[model samples]
Target: MAIIPRLSTPQTSPDTGPARNNRRGMMWLAADLCFNIWALSIAKSLGVDLPPIQIVLVRALVGLAVLIPFVVWRGGMVRLANPKLQILRTMLSTIAMTGNFFAVAKLPFALFTTVNFTRPLLMMALAALILGERIRAKQWIAGGIGLIGVVIAVDPGSLGATSASGIGALFASVIAGTSAVIILRRMRNEDALTQMIWQTAGLSLTSVLPAIYFWQAPGDHWPILLSIGVLSQTAQFCFMRAHYWAEAGVIAPLGYFSLILSVTVGYFVFDEVPSIGLYLGAVLIIGAALMASHKGKRG
Candidate 1:
């Protein structure tokens, strides 16, 4: 029922462009990717019996712990102007995170990364169908090309369909994109750190019950769990700051670099080599991201 104060937009000289900001965003994104790869590999390597929900909950707790000191030092819990919207966004985020963690355990690292980039495609669809936003023929064509990449990556006809983990990745991808939609619609004006912190809190809370129900103590991997928390919290902070410096679309394609890095990690850490389809899928996803960036944002 109440409206938050609107700040005047800053003006930038045309010559300045978004290069500097995009570069900064690139660093933040790369860091996020590294931590992400490390966490996923840790989870898989732990060889524990814990369910994905439990792993996610532990991750949330770790992120919250890392955030608490900063949230206190930087002026304590960021007040929400719209608590209801914030809560809604947090719920969607938890679901997305759950599916993602599950997928990380199920699919190969390179394949998981390939599917994740398809978020742009989902965003394009939501923009067109849900918001009734007008899309150009070029965007649609680009999206189609991206879809082709996804199919090639998953090759779902038989091999993919039967694998629960593979399906989890699909579930996670769509849910993650939906969460992006919620953020774009309602949380656009919120402080990035504040929203992230609160959403993470919500994530921890939402996951607690499920985590408890399926609880399995992360025996012998406590250090790895701690690392997951620290890495994810830092990554989220960097991710927030990155967007502050530039448009999300500008930094979106830089994600391809993460895929490349993930492939390297997959090979060395997981002993997994990318297949031809995986390489092909990466190309399509990157190309689609470039095309989509010309039009909009990442999922």
Candidate 2:
């Protein structure tokens, strides 16, 4: 999952020093990852019947609705900076989210989640390309390893309809999501809540018309629909708090748990028994991500 930009807060408060906060941060990050996966999994389950656009619309609307009161409570949208960049980032985020919903519906849960692990590699490359950051040899090697893992899991030789189109959507979503994160890193001075409001509002607006055109009255699934928004936004809150409380390296290992969660959920909840290739590929992907993150921290 993409890490939400850090909220504006002091690095260390008198009430909680670095050690205590680091522990708290890791816990929050773990919760955030769990909620995020659960939200996506719920969307995937719903996607079996509902239109992907409609699901995206509901998620975005619920997210926006939840943010409105918070925005009002903290005084109106007065903290925004770099409006153009914000719009650009929001547009990428919208594309990323819509594509993610589409992929979740089409791909196996395990495959989809594993493919997402490549986002860090993509982000690292984007940093080098867009931000003109130097790419060390080890990082490049990690990216190569991640790509190989993806190929192993995808098994391009057996490209059926399942792997072909969903793979495209999955990668597109990951790239767009990585781009949004790159932009977020650029907007470090911008208020985190303001960025979130813009994102939710943008997603809602972009998806509304399509949703209306393809409108299906969520019927009995309204509760599930509502939960997507609630869970996702809560997860985003945890993500922001996690960053505020600790360095990325301190919380990085917890991210590997997502794969275990994905595999378990895929098997039990979705009855997806991935082949041995998937397990092998996942190991390589996770190892590469860990190496990249570690090198990133050191750099």
lDDT tens per residue, model 1, 1-299: 00112122334678974344567667767776677677677766653356777877888887777667767777888798778877777677767776766667667788888888877777777777767778888888888999898888777764653355656655665666575564557567877567767877888898899889998766776777777777666665566556656677667666678788778888898898888987987799779868865844568
TM-score, one value per model: 0.83, 0.90
- Model 1 quality (TM-score): 0.83
lDDT of 1: 0.71
Q: Name the best candidate (by TM-score).
A: 2
Task: Evaluate all candidate structures by whole-model CA lDDT and list the values in order.
Answer: 0.71, 0.82
The digit string of per-residue lDDT tens for model 2 on 167-283 reads 888888999999999998999998666777877787788778878998887889989988988888788878878877777877877887888888888899999998899888988
Which window of 10 residues has the lowest lDDT sum in candidate 1? Answer: 1-10
